[model samples]
Target: VVGAGPAGMTAAYYAALKGHAVTVFDMMEKQGGIARYGIPEYRLPKVKLDKELNSVWQLRDTEFKGGKMLGRDFSIDDLFTQGYDAVFLGLGAWRSNELRVPGEDLPGVIEAINYLRMNSEGNPVPVGKGQKVVVIGGGFTTFDCARTSRRLGADVTVVYRRSRKEMGAHYSEVDDAEHEGIRLEFFAAPVRFVEKNGRVGGVEFQRMALGEPDASGRRRPVPVEGSNFVIECDTAIPAIGQVPNLDFFEREQGVRKTKRETVITNGALMTDRPGVFAGGDVQMGARTVIECVAQGKLAAKAIDRYLAGDDMARVAEEIAEEEAVPELIDIVPYKPEEPQVRMPMLPFKERDLSFQLIENGYDKNAAEKEAARCLQCVCPDVGRCHLQRLSLEHGLTDNRFHRAEPVDYHDYEYDFSHDFILRDLNKCINCTQCVRICRDVIGANCYGLMGGGYDSIVTTPWNVSLKYTDCVSCGACAETCPTGALMMRERDLQTYELDIVRCIYCGDCVEVCPHGALGETPNFELSTYGRFGRTVLAKEELAVARTWKPSEEIPLDGHNSPRPPEIRPPGPPRWGD
Candidate 1:
């Protein structure tokens, strides 16, 4: 077994579990390759990584050796001669793509992968006296580089050849960078790097315009002649892309390559040579860590089949079936009414000079609240309510189970400020359905997790209310709310009514009420009104009623009386106040 990334590690674990004498080798000292190096600690913490790596370490018959470059230390022939029945090449793409420009070799120029790896390892690069830094690319790497520079006391700017909408990075990541004061210049292409005295100085760029849709369906960027401009900066980080290092395969053992220069593999990921297989970034190009894991597992199964001398045709069919099936859970049609739990962020000022983690992970309470918002898509309970089913199954009329610590509902003022839906923090259950729908489906970063712990609650940048935020009022959040918490405020009529009198202290109303309007109260005077017309009152109305009283009047008996009649002002309306 070779490589130590998620894919390689997973493959090694399974191979060992299956009783194969596995020996893993990697160039890095640690087991987690790109994940440990490329990703930021706040995004994928080392502790979580250690837990995963430790799981791999527990596999029997597995031996891990780090800091061993495959071709340099041993060749494919050496593995076959060592009595290993099969060899798996899981070497991942660790090389950074070059800009191929004039000043790319300047002293201050850097690659995204190296920068992230260094910083994640607590050995950050030194930025010279000048405060300006520029990043060129349009993906997650670009944002990571820019954000890292911002945290290192640089006034960072991102230069992309495409428009903001065309950015390939997660919208939330881009928004986070912007929130930290990272400037962006879109419709721009870097022409050449500007350097002085053997040091980086600035970048010359040309204005670009969107052209007709290319073969990829995206509008291609066309450089406008005579529109070149230069921006001065201390450093430039190019994060255009990354590719697999194929030198080991080529030099150590003559393995064939695809037209794109990746290793050529067979139906089961076996290279052109026998008893050798490859997978992960080296096979699928640079992709998500999850994808790498899936590939590694596939390679392991293939390796097992080869070792057992099973028919390759049968393995191909199985692999096809596995690839055809979707990985996401089939959730029921239930809407998620919970508000998104906010991820805590570092202050902008401090962000300029500190590499401190930005987002704080959710606590247990916050995790449970956020998890409750899941729609459980494709499950039988999709449209039907699971909480209701669970309550019925357990014969629970009241919430006798542990209650989550209460959040300060009043911190965020209810802004009837939007047309489609109302945002009332008091009613939100910390479900992230709205955030998911907006990001995954709509590709908009309008909403995101903010704050931390109990204080954490989803919000837009600058803490702008939904109306003032970039919300297009698409109603997706309302559509997926399991409880009526985030329902469309403009619905012709409110279909549900709260019967606080018969509520029996059951939180069904609270848990299912997405709007946060129906809340817990110490005063259950809802019993005062007749059972048929119990009403739900807004906090404001309740506050006003507390201060109301009848004006002074004389009694018909003769003397003025201080006491009022026992008759109560007719109880509140049935629907709501």
Candidate 2:
């Protein structure tokens, strides 16, 4: 892999996972590409980023060589000769696009990427305190330059030809920059840098208006007639965008690139040149980090297939099959609305003149809460479900209960009312474990055996939803179910408890529990003494209450005495009579 950006790192990880000898090389001293150097510390902290990247190093037979230039250190031909089977080119875009106006070559005109890179590396250039800095462009890089300059105590101003609504940068980031004291000027394009004594003193801009949609499907900016203006600034930074730096290699170097300078690849992520693969910003022409990661993953699979001498056609089909999005059913699961966790940050006053890393990542509690809200997007007890396992074991290809006539079978709607539990009537086997557990163990008597014999089923009382029941959403009934009838869904932080013996829904003491608040832990335990004075309550008893207890007076000579009274608490609230 060439370049250690998100794509390169992902490709290396997946390729190495498939038992391949992988080597990643980059020209920078650090492994991460733009994420480490181009992005500001406030957005992505290096420590967390490094911890993730360190995993790539831990992979067996995977090597990362920092400060190794592609053409200078070794060419593609050299890699083949060096006995490597294949090569991946994730060379990210490094060169900033030129502003192309007159006086742009003057001193104090900074290229956005290089300026941000320098600042990220702790090497301050011309920008400093009391300097009036004007940045050109309206994207992530533009805001990075403007905000970074503002952090350095420079009176920073951003000029964009398009409206703020049409900006390439995320709206939150643009708003953040505004909140950080960076001035914004829209509908203006840079004309030229105003020079004083051969150094930049200000910038001249032309007013623009929205024109017809361009090739990018966005409204093109048209220059307004005679609407030129000037803003005085000590420094000028043009952050238009960046393209892949392909200076070392030529057009006829076997690999091919589009007119926009992005490498054109086959469906399998392979360049025109055999055994050489390209992905990330170099191939996609400066896209988001997530997009780069997907391309990287795709390229890794393609490279693996190519190395194994598999047919490219089959490989393309398999790649497409994997990448194809699964068709979602129209029934959207109604998940409770929860606000996203806001990342903590330093106050605006503290941010000035200090790059002391901004975003304080989520602590354990915050992370757990945030993670519990994942919708799971999947069933928690999928593999371990005894019902699913038994069905597979018995070769249950078709449901014998699903009758041809609609009236022959009851199609009861799903009960998603309970916050942390999902009740699917189709999967219920009428074992009465949920009814018994809810009444006996949890005391949240939310369920009962309902209806006549032929049409009988277990559900919330009066068949009128669980919201009206005494269910606390403790997930005890769910944890006790023998099948997928009652499933404990994800619920962060909001938890309930149960005891063993009477809680026959589960044969074990501790269950994985719902998603959010906590994992299923034995918060409710009943300690009992055996014949030899050993606490023998075990895992199965962990889920139930003691149905049979020892007598108050201990009979020493192994006499199996009469059973003690069943200690029962008041049952869960009653909704119906």
Candidate 3:
């Protein structure tokens, strides 16, 4: 097996599990391909990654060798000659895309991927302090480049050719840049770089406007004439996009190439050459990790079929059955909850010259609370939870009614910072769908379960408010909320109300309210004329009503007097006389 990324690793695991002797080769020192180097440790920590890597390494029949570059060290023919049954090419895309501008050859211009790789590998390069750095791109790499430059003591800024909403970077990442004082210039594209002393000293940019939708269905950025501007900077980083590296396959024997320089394969993932296959980034370009894993598994099964000399159709069906599992419950159609983690940062004065890790990881209790919010998208515990089903089967209603006391309404706080996803501690059932999505799917470990026993809850680092944590507003949490606790704020506004009863002494409401409006008291009393037309008496109105009484006699000429047309009864007076 070639490569050791998610797909390659998963393929090796499954192949070994099926009692096949597998040997995997990678160019890097570690097994986790892009995941180990491309992502930051703060997001996907080394510990968690180690756990996964170890599981794969423990496969008795699988072997992994690092520092082995294909084509350069050993060709595909060499592997076949070495008595290996077959070869699977999973080499990922590593070459970074260039800006292709005039001054891009200058000393200060660097590829964003290369820069990130160097940083991730702990390699020291020239990113001088007190220098101005500009990053061009709208993807996550651009943000990473900008933020990393900031840590290196450079005044960092991001220049994107599109609007903020169109940016490919995750929202939380963009928000982190903003929160960390990283300046962003939107609707701008790099025209050229200005060089001095054979090094980049500044950059010239062209203002761009959104044009008609292109083939990709996204509005293409078109340069506006006569809108060129220049900004002086010490360095410039290009993070436009990436493509597959097919140099190994191109030079290898009996390998067919596609028009796009990708590997050509038949129905069994076998190249035109027998016993040779390719998958993952080398086959699909730079895609998501999940896609890579899926490709790896498919390639493994195809290799097995080739070795067994079985019919491809039957083999494919068996592989599909192994991959597919039946769902016990159908979940309600819900959007993912927007992430609410926000990390408070150091003061501006402190940030100007520090390289400290800005956002801390979640603590034990905070991790649990945040994990509990996960929607657990593919889990079987959605509408037909075994606990709830069993309870109903036993005719249990209000199972703990005797022990249930009135919960302090004021103790429960609400977080509505993101357009989607609401956070209310009162309604959480402690299911961990949100946590799983954030960690496994989104590739952002922003949520986790924390604390012990009854004190436990899902939260971010330091038990901070979701609006102040490192959450990226992915909506995975709100999507998994079984109860109405965590919901999209935009979908339901009436759910937020200041109840007059059951308020405890806790001040959670004051702390968790992202908007101050929730805590502000208006002078207007609950009248039947407002939007909802529901009268809610204030504390003062209730007090006044308790002391009021009706008078014994009716007024004749006052506002409460009867009209003159109404005559009083004189018979009662005559009978009394």
Q: After best superposition, candidate 3 residue 36: deviation in angstroms?
A: 2.5
Please, what is the TM-score per model? 0.62, 0.66, 0.59
Candidate 3 lDDT at 223 equals 93
lDDT of 3 by residue, 457-539 (tens): 77666766676654555465665556655665545243666665544312334433322334525553432112233234553
* Tens digits of per-residue lDDT for model 2, 331-439: 3455676788878777777888877777777887888888767765344344345455457569995876566787878777898887777888977779887886567
| Model 3 weakest 10-residue run by lDDT | 565-574
Q: How much lDDT does candidate 3 score?
A: 0.70
Candidate 3 contains a number of clashing pairs equal to 39
Model 1, span 122-206: residue lDDT tens: 8848553348989999898888788877767788889999999989999988887888888999999988899877888899999
Please report the candidate that would top lDDT against the real structure: 2
Q: Per-model C-alpha lDDT, please?
A: 0.73, 0.78, 0.70
Between candidates 2 and 3, the one scoring higher on TM-score is 2
Best by TM-score: 2
In model 2, which runs have C-alpha deviations exceeding 4 angstroms? 251-253, 362-369, 379-577
Of models 2 and 3, which has the larger lDDT? 2
The superposed Cα distance between candidate 1 and the true structure at residue 129, in angstroms, equals 7.0
Off by over 4 Å in 3: 266-268, 313-329, 333-577
